[model samples]
Target: GFKIGGAEVSRKHAGFIVNTGHATARDVLDLIAHVKRVVKAKLGVELETEIRVIGDL
Candidate 1:
């Protein structure tokens, strides 16, 4: 678990995955969806992404 803006942001070990190299906006969006699904299924909490996804996927 890691902290961000006084909130516990993630549980699956932060800094494990990153958008360091050539990560487009769509790539980040996909990653966010995948993470939400995984956390929802495992933790039974519906996680809401803080960022707004614009445009089509």
Candidate 2:
């Protein structure tokens, strides 16, 4: 699921690497970052993660 401009997004073509539960924000963020880097390098298109990261350092 994703939201844009404060509205729920219903598009299906977007790529999302979701956390499979029991994952901390840090874990998800790290995975998202890695995906962005890899996808950009391999496909030449920049992908953004839709999750918001918050809480503790």
Q: Pick by TM-score: which candidate is best?
A: 1
Question: Candidate 1 on 1-57: residue-level lDDT in tens?
Answer: 432223342456653445444656666666666667778999998876777767776
Q: Give the alpha carbon lDDT tens digit for every residue of 1-57 in model 2.
A: 443222322255436444444555555566566667777999998975566656664
What's the lDDT for all of these models? 0.59, 0.55
TM-score of 1: 0.61
Candidate 2 pairs with clashing backbones: none
lDDT of candidate 1 at residue 1, scale 0 to 100: 42
Poorly placed runs, candidate 1 (over 4 Å) = 1-17
> 5, model 1: CA deviation in Å?
26
Model 1 residue 48 lDDT?
Answer: 68
